[model samples]
Target chain A: MINSIDLILVLILLAVLLSLGSSRMMALIKIMALQGAMVSLVPIFIEPQARLSNGGILFFQLMLLIKAVLIPGLLYMALNRIAIKREVEPLIGYHASLLVGLGLVMLSAYITRRMGLSLPGDYALLLITAITTTGGGLFLMMSRTKAITQVIGYLMLENGIYLVGTALTKHTHNIYLVEFGVLLDLLAGVMIMGIILHNINRAFDDVDTAYLEQLKD
Target chain B: MLEAVFCLPLFAGLIAFLLPVKLGRGVLVVGALLHLQLTLLAWLSDFPPLLPGYFSTAPAGILVLLVTSFIFVFIAPYSIFYMREQEMQSEPIFIGSMLLFLGTMSMAALAEHPIVFWIAIEATTLVSAPLIFVNRSKKALEATWKYVLICSVGIALALLGFFFITLSMDRAGIDVPLTFSSLNTAAKHLDPLWLKIGFIFVIIGFGTKMGLAPMHTWLPDAHSEAPSPASALLSGALLNCAFLGIFKVHTLMVLAGLGDFSGSLLIGFGLFSILVAGIFILKQPDYKRMLAYSSIENMGVIAFGVGIGGMALYGAMLHLIHHSLLKSSLFLSAGNLLLGFGSKIVAQCGGMTRLLPRTFVSFFAGFLGISGLPPFGVFVSELLILIGAFKAGHPVAGGLFIASLALVVAGFARIVTSMSFGPSRQEILVPEQTLRIVSPFALLLTSAVLCVWMPEPLHQIIINTIAVIGGTIHG
Candidate 1:
């Protein structure tokens, strides 16, 4: 089950995420699409064993389709609507974010190793991918300045959490519903927040949080 | 009927949405009264006992729900005058949202399921978001933004903490359900490592909602920017709802064999919040924000007491009750001052004692009660917390607690003396001519009575109830 295709998929995901944490907002969306592609393969890699029930396979495919493809498509539409161009300024510089993302990836691996998340004792790369994606998403959140960018960061974080649950298929079933609910909620959250971002830009002429100080005492 | 306590508010919220504006504000009071009535019924029943997981009301939440419901009852009428004075036409939306906000808070308190509790907590963030935006001011929008972003991020981390709690139970080979009963029953089997991580995340998440230090940046702005009645609910009841989450999780942490891990973290965050509030309040120029920061400090004291554990949890719960009354009164009075003097900055307006004697007196009383002066509820709560800290061998925290309280007291003293008792700036002062001016007086009186004497029967029940929840893990 340790397929070369799966390894290549994860490597591409990593390369894309490395781009997401950079100042290039357009590049961030491309990386998101690549990460999206890798997430769709997670179910196949986890259990190509016909040892699964029909219902399980159906749900798996549904998750892959909805999460990896449909959600990204919706976000792409939003990107076109808002037209926020590349991030003009970020709270933390993009280069520093890349370094921090690297450190978080390392931390995720360490934490996973401690928790024994590597299933089949052979899929060490799965553990690495889970941590890297989650860390990268968080890095996007911390470094990004644009409000839309923050929303995108949150979406990537959801992708990371999805991988965590997917890797743990051997342990539970109830978690699948929770993961779906989380994704739905996250996607809805991004869409609503995107609208709010548009309003902020329209009202203030800039979506940067720098001018959000109108409420202070 | 027990579940009805939460559902009734939801129903009221929906009905309010369909009503006329003038009728809507009036309907909000009706909803709040009904909510209080339902809370009393639940308090009298056995059906809604803490769920079968870790810790719930047989220990800590009964008192929380009762006190919160009781204060909401008083604040409901106060809100009527608040709305009427503003000539609010969109009352239905505000009232409906407020009902949902309170309903979700009760759900969080009475939740048997951990996931249910998280959902309820998240619901509060959504429902309260609209309430903060009730004024639709630029400032309101800004504050609402901070409130939503910070609290949502905080609650998300809390959810992650829930994930860790489940992960820990998995490690221990016990099928510990997320219910209070199940968690407590299986607590001994929980993995310590995962519990530590879970407790930290839960603390920070709920702590942000509670306005605990470092994560408390949203409290002052949101509290000061919202309408007074909303601020009353926020400072009085909402923070307690968040604290209930932390308290419940800590109960499980104790049973997980990582004794004091959660408690120490609470104490650390609590003490830091108090110190931060004290430092900032000493130089604060805005009185409303100062009061907001004072709230952060009081929440810190409660956290410290809860972290101390054992007897300290009881003290923490007691302080939770007293502080709610004191703070809501203070905020309501701030509203009166705002109405009378039309300014929030301390330097811009004053001579309140000469301008409006009744409001000035009530404001000072609230300030005194919050400062832990004798004969008030805060004084008694503080004493209990200090005793609990010493009992838990946290004498250093106890010492720092006294120093921080003194610093806060001094800062508040200067503000009260300067704002209420002395010179007025050039701002125009209007004469009080309506019932709205008198409503704050009434709220402060209820709080004053609670401080002076929390009826014996209620106190006995609440104290016993808290002990049961707090002791569930240890037993």
Candidate 2:
């Protein structure tokens, strides 16, 4: 039966496609923020009847805050700092990327069906969305030229992995602690990338990965 | 008490961030010494984990910890002298980041929980990024960018692998804690299919950080761009932390009766890395980049030996320790060369034999030692691995191993000869100092001494480390 969890998962998939096709950096950041919030809410929806303790409530809220507000906020600041607006001249054009995104959905669905792991409560849809988000993130990284976009892609990849972790493993006592640490690392990684983005802009007048090809062997 | 081995350096690093540059340098050295003392204490005595579930002193973890601590004791002091000659934008940040990097690596070594190990490793990448970019040059910025983005993504996959491992346990109806030690004990119950998938992802994830080829693109650039002492630590200590992650998982695989699958994969990556390093080292322009590729080669050697099992696993352990010592020494001596000639390009350097006599001795000796000459531990380790490979009935792979070693040595010799004996080209920029030269010599001497006389405790540790995987001392 259709439920709120599937709705959220479907929205996340749409956001992934939108991110792949969007030419503007600001729209991409917004898409990521929406995707992050939706992804963080999946665990709550999956286990709605298993009332969360105080610690679990606080952990989920913190996850939502970081995933939705902090990370995209950092990217937004980084975008403004670098002063780059539109993603110019992607390696793959927008239309092709959109088509590829659809292909990724089908691929993920097939794989999820092939390895049937008796998950509970619309988790098949969740796994498909997770795999598509991951593949989309990796594709974005390889196909985009801007460093900021690559960071966005990395965040998307991380969100997908987090979803996989949630859907696959049962919640243990220390799981929240580990997840919190991962969230903090995500925050710090974005901050460091922001600093490097500013430097890359100052040094080269652009944040394009094209200019970073000098030191290669 | 075991936690203090990492905690001491971390607190010191936080203080280094606030202190003045002069005092920060003092903190760096003192922190290193205290860390070494704590490491010795943990090694010599039984120091129980403060957090029993997440942190423990396993044999493999402690071995990596000891090697890291020993290398830091020398690299910390060498960094002080190395930094004195050149001005950095933020000296305090550099020193602070070095200590934080040490703390993260120590945490990775001693971590028993899978997720905790992943956290420690990811923290290392963040902390060490500052060390690479301390110079703030454009190339340094590029290198830092690659190092962070690549390692973060790579380690993210490792986290996914850990999740898969947890999933395997869940599928088996096991309710054990998620530490590696517990995972090993419960491994036989895990579904083999999921375990295999987890190992693939884990190896790719950790192997990338360990500088295994096909994922080692960031290594040469980051190592070459980082300041010398930072490069030394990256080569000597940081890579071992990543290898420890892979080694732990490989042991789990062996326990699960997946040794052949994991071993073949390790051998494949190992040989590929050696080939890649050999090809790149030939016609290499930068001396520092050459040393970085050499690190990739050594990592490959260690992976190969471990994959072969039996006597070769013991060789891998010896190689791990000796590689840390000799490679750090080489990088320090290369630092002296950079200080003397003011260039990293080999063609721009010449007549180090005449220009800097003391550095020349250490550099040439390091070259010989790294090339697997006698009076050094690499020679012994390489011989053991080769013999182990043949005995394991992998004659073709053994032959390729020897061929690649020859190619690497030939390329390495050409570069070393020209750089040391080529016609005099440039004037010395900074005169050699006793402090700058002593650490490298001391590091090299330690390797030689260990080769001649294997310490009882270290030997016992190696035995304990490989005993689970069916590795024996006698061929």
- Report lDDT (CA) for all predictions: 0.74, 0.93
TM-score for chain A in each prediction: 0.81, 0.96
Question: What tens digits encode model 2's per-residue C-alpha lDDT throughout B1-475?
Answer: 7999999999999999999999999999999999999998898899998799989989999999999999899999999999999887799999999999999999999999999999999999999999999999999999999999999999999999988888889889999888999999998999888889999999999999999999999999999999999999999999999999999999999999999999999999999999999999988989999999999999999999999999989999999999999999999999999999999999899999888999999999999999999899999999999999999999999999999988889889999999999989657999899999999999999999999998899999899999988999796
Positional deviation of residue A119's Cα in model 2 after best superposition, in angstroms: 1.1
Model 1 C-alpha lDDT per residue in residues A133-217, reported as the tens digit of each score: 7667767767766766776676676666556645543444344444455555555555546555665666676666667887543
| Most lDDT-accurate candidate | 2
Model 1 Cα lDDT, one tens digit per residue, B204-310: 88888989989999999999888888898899999998988888787777766665677788899999999999998998888888989999999999888877876
- Candidate 2 clashes between residue pairs 3 or more apart in a chain or in different chains: none
Looking at model 1, residue A153 earns an lDDT score of 73
Candidate 2: regions farther than 4 A off: A49-51
iRMSD value for model 1: 3.1
- Docking class of predicted structure 2: high
| Regions more than 4 Å wrong, model 1 | A1-12, A15-83, A92-96, A99-103, A114-123, A162-188, A214-217, B48-59, B87-90, B425-434, B437-439, B468-475
